[model samples]
Target: MNVYISADMEGISGVVHGAQTEPGAREYDRACALMLGEVNAAVEGALAAGAARVVVNDSHWNMRNLRIEELHPAAELISGSPKPFSMVQGLDASFDAALFVGYHAMSGTSPASIDHTYTDAIHHVWLNGREVGEIGINAAFAGFHGVPVALVTGDQMATAEARALLGEVATVQVKEAYSRSAARCLPVAEARRLVREGARAALAQRRGPLRFDAPYALKVEFVNTGQAEMAALMPGSERLDHRVVQYSHTSYVEVYRAWRVFYNLAGAA
Candidate 1:
């Protein structure tokens, strides 16, 4: 079976500060190492569980955080930014299952470390009035291509969000957040152990893709009114208020495309 892993950084073991996730910060290098360890653990787990192929996507800030030389030899890495799909860029129907590692919670999540939905531009996202985070959005994108989200690894808040939206998928918590930039983290070794085991079990799950019903309605609440007003300028997107824009699509894929436009516009804020 083919497995896809999308790796972010803020939710990695021991990561709790913005400096650690930024590309040039002194702690950033260490953060990358931690991120790589979790990813390799997931890779090892998926391979051990009999996956024939595995691919890793670097889905954090610039989308190029993973150290290529340190990546598992068993998986190919997709990195770099400006890709149309962003976090779930490489996803398609060919993959059997998708795993999310090092992902954080939504913006404004209480005590969720460094939480934000997709980018720094937004406060949160809503699908059919249901508040959804990055994990949910990416899972839905994968599902649109018929790939089930089988596992997620991050912090306690991340796991809670995943369970709430995606049901009981396997999960491994690297940390428990005390606030946006503080958390009680497991030792590196223990977190890796949990991640590997969780991955192995998650890949064995028989769950199907989680698809949103068609005619998807999306509401994106931007960081400010200017961003919202800018997003509303997009075709078919309507300004709901000073900070939210509403967009509808006949297909999930279309909604996703519009989502990209919406956020790109919002990111200017």
Candidate 2:
């Protein structure tokens, strides 16, 4: 099996505050080490389960969080950013299964650690009238290429939302959020054990794409009026109101691409 993993940082065990996830924080180094341990565990578990190849994408902010030098020898890493697909950049039809490691809940989700879809500039993202976060959007992108999101690990809300969106698979809850910036986390060792086992079990199940109906409508709501105005500048997007812009496309890839544009422009504006 060829497996693709999109790894984010906010939901990693022991990560709660902005300081833990972003650069310049005192604990950021320790947080990065924890992230590498969890992700490496997942990679090791996948390889042990008979995977032919495993590709790990450093999908966190700036797209460069994982320590490439310390990554598992059996896995290939795709790090750094500005890729067309963003979080799911290296994804394609060739992979047999997909895993989201250390993903978080969407904006406004209660009791979620460091939760936000992409950036603070955007409020929420809706696809075909259904609200989704980074997890949902990335799962849809993977599905577009005929891949199934087999497992997801993160905080309580993160795992719950994944089960809600992608149906029952395998999940590892590394922490339970007490607030947006606080959580009751598992010890690093226990978190790694859960992730390793979860990945192995998730891959053992049958693999299939999480179907998104064709002719998708991608809508984004920004935090400010100017952001929405800037997003509406995109060719196909229609301004629904002061803060929201909607774009329609028949292809999932096109819809995803438009979504990327909408968020990028909105954030930069």
Candidate 3:
């Protein structure tokens, strides 16, 4: 089996504050180490379960948190920032399964640590009128590639939210949120054990490849109207409210590209 692991930092064990996930802070170094450890555990577990290949994408803030040399020898790593697919970079219609490790919740989710979707500038994202977050969007990407999201590990809220969006996938809660910036985390070792177990179990039940719903419709609400107006210029995007723009596509790739345009509007402003 070919497995793809998208790893984020905020929900990693021991990450409890903004500084922990922010670059250049002393806390960030420790957090990165923890994130790396959890990722290694996931990769190791996949290998133990007869995975033919494993790729780990460091899908955090700057996307360069993982130490390449320190990564597992059996796994390939994709790490960088400003990529076209952002968190879902390197994804395509080839993998058998995907795993999201150390993820958080959507923006405004109560008790979630370091919660935000894509960028803090955007307030919410909806697909076919249903609310979603990084988990949902990435799962859509995985689905587009004809791969099932086999497992996800993160904070309790993120796990719950992901389960709600991608029915029956395995999930591991590494922490319980106290707020957007804080959480009550499991010990790093315990969290890694759970991730390993979840990964093994999820892959055991992996069915046929999954695909995102086609003719996708997406709506995005920004923190400001300027962002929405900027996004509304995309061919099929329409202004739906003071801060929301909705777009429809005949394919998941189109919707993914449209979402990229919407996310970039704020940067252009």
Predictions: Cα RMSD each: 1.0, 1.0, 1.5
Candidates ranked by lDDT: 2, 1, 3
lDDT of 3 at 213: 57
Off by over 4 Å in 1: none
Task: Please write out the lDDT profile of model 1 over residues 162-201, one tens digit for every residue.
Answer: 9888887888888999999899999999999999999999
Better of 1 and 3 by lDDT: 1
Distance (Å) between predicted and true CA of 110, model 1?
Answer: 0.9
TM-score of each: 0.97, 0.98, 0.95
Name the lDDT of candidate 1: 0.89
lDDT of each candidate versus the true structure: 0.89, 0.90, 0.86
Candidate 2 is scored at a TM of 0.98
Worst 10 residues of 2 by lDDT: 206-215
Taking the tens digit of each residue's C-alpha lDDT, what string does model 3 give over 1-269?
A: 89999999887888978788888998888989999999999998898788999999999889999999999999999988778888888988778899999988988798788888888778988887779999988888888778889888888889999878888878999899888776788988999998887888888897544444557889889999888778887888889899988888888777888898898886565
Candidate 2, 1-269: lDDT as tens digits: 99999999998998899877777678888888888999999998898778999999998877777878899988999988798988898899999999999999998899999889888887888988889999999998988889999999999999999989988768899999999989999999999999998999889994677887878998888999999998999998899989999999889888888888888898778
